[model samples]
Target: MKYLLLSIFLCTLLACTPGSATKYPYTIRDFPDSLRTDLRKIVNYGFIGSPSYESAGNIRMQISDNDCKRLALSEHPILRSLALDILCNRHHLDHYSIMMQHLDDTAYVNWYYQCASFTFITVSDFMVKEYKWYTEEEKNRTVEKIIRDHNYLQSAYEALHKTTLTEAHYPFVRKMAEKETLMKFRSEALLHLAGYKKISDTGFLHNALYQSRHELDANAFGIMELYQDPFYFAMLKKYFPGGYYRNFCKKDFERNTTENALSYVSALASYRSEESAAILEKILFQDPLVPCFPADTFRLRQHLYEVIEKNTCEHYSKMLRVVKPWLERERKESAENGFPIDTTSFYQFPSDSTNPPKIRW
Candidate 1:
């Protein structure tokens, strides 16, 4: 027992000795000093929530009325001098030094947050416009890219998993798998591409892999599908494969629905068929509680009433007026088909504890 203890002690001491384990064969520290310096600058200046540490005066002064013209003339000595002065004065060497040590750490965080927020705002606006800016070529390119990226991820994972022996390799392999899955799942670019194509070709809009209205961009196709067509809704279900619809249905009703409905109503007004009018009436008189209830259903109804009164076709005008009273009655009684009366069921409204007024006569 004494001999065994001595052997254990010797082994522990050896393990703790300096340079006992072999160092990695490669080191990133070998990168050139100039490259390292630039990298460091990126890290320091890009950290999230890190103080800009730049002088407010410098930031303000950088934005001149003629800055656009100066930028266009990229080789201008004056512009270059101004830029250098700003960099040197606003961020001291100490700040640059700190940034170099953690270059990617700060840069990646800042880029990720900026991209994420911008994507959210862009998507929301795009959806509101039914993806007006998206073109066919762009959609196809996005789809192809997603396919390529996904295949590359798969190949990398398979290669690593087959060759690695150390247990430490498992974490990396697992991470690759997760990344691939997430790309397949929440790849907004790919999903939007598919959605844009589907809507343009089939009159049906589909949801993206992820809903980014709050973070990246809201799926315009998804919004249209929710309000306009059952076909697009089915596409959303097929792609998402879970309770995605239920979650989507819970968004602010009047805001999303009213916008979509208005767009649809305006586009269909020229058709003037009974079917179209009936569809308009149905939308205009939906139960205020439905997920897609218009924000201004009352106003929409009043407008429709005026349109009907002014129509040149006597029969069409008569039919519209006839339908208007029934719709109004249904709205008052909370009895519109497919539309519920309680808008507050899908979203909370700001109000005191007092009971809401009843719509009944």
Candidate 2:
């Protein structure tokens, strides 16, 4: 009961400007009673299609240290999430103390992720809802600006990475980095911040590559990519035998257009290590998984090989011993019979999955 009341008070309290008694635009009550009822319904359903995104006016109320502490203690996921966003927004050195504690809580993992999921759905989702008020013409007409303005997910990450994590928070971030699951972008954002501040735990990162549990498909890989610290040659094998490649590649690779595969290759080539060359060579000879189109992949292999050849000459000798004969044979075969037309356009491959699926369409 206390938890419920606290939740209600906090939810309501979120509307107020922090450190000031003044409510800048208007309280939820300022809306017409009918509109307010409709707004509550939209909030309840967990969608943000209603006029509320605009109506809310990007209200970011401050969370006082007392309230920040209270929020950290709440068992409720929603409040826990709110606490995270508030701390990120506050950017004070003091908030680090509580955030570090949450980072260590095993149960708090999902709660932090849920909070990270965005305290609000982005305009991208809103455009899909196509509220009559927002989308009379095609959303394409104005969505670019709208999206840039309303990306809460980006805001959450920026707020987090931009804040300084003092020695108080360093131990905690390191602890979370050791085993935190499925927190890709923000995890890297924080990791990069840690790197900037020199709060490193390279040993933990090296060990984490071998552990497989994940929250999202890209979590571990993304952070590993971010560190490029004491760069691991084993990240090359993740392209082949790494736990992430097997588990998430099947489910998520088709979506990444095998850039996930390329990611491993890119990181591997970056190391220029013998092990990196060997792993790429091992995978190079193998057939691709079901979702992978062989024709496109043939080019991808060519691209990766070139990367390795350029980056690591010492190891390239072994690769050349085998690859030179294979390329000659392929050329001979092409001359004997016309080359199989390249169905996969290397030009068409996405550099990254930055263009998220369209919500407005």
Give the best candidate by lDDT.
Answer: 2
Winning model by TM-score: 2
Local accuracy of candidate 1 as per-residue lDDT tens digits, 1-361: 9999999999999888644123212121333343334323433454321233232233325443233223212232222222222332332233222211211110012212343342121111121112211234443332233233432332232223123234433334333423433342333323333333343433311222233222212334333433445443333333321232233354654234334333233434434556555554554455552344224556555555545544435435645656567657766776535654686668766775454332110
TM-score of each: 0.27, 0.43
Name the lDDT of candidate 2. Answer: 0.45
Candidates in order: C-alpha RMSD to true structure: 20.1, 14.0
By summed lDDT, the worst window of 10 consecutive residues in model 1 runs over: 99-108
Clashing pairs in 1: 40-99, 40-100, 44-99, 119-216, 119-217, 120-216, 123-217, 127-220, 289-342, 289-343
- Candidate 2: misplaced stretches above 4 Å? 1-37, 40-45, 50-181, 190-194, 197-200, 207-231, 234-239, 242-249, 252-257, 288-299, 318-361
Candidate 2 lDDT over 1-361, as tens digits, reads 9999999899889766463333122333544453444334434444322233342223224334555455434443333344454554454444423333343222222111132343343322222222222223433433332223332333233333434445554544454454443455445434544464463455555555554333323435555555565544444453456542443344443343444555556666666667667776676666563234333566666666666655657776777676666666777888999866777755775555654343322
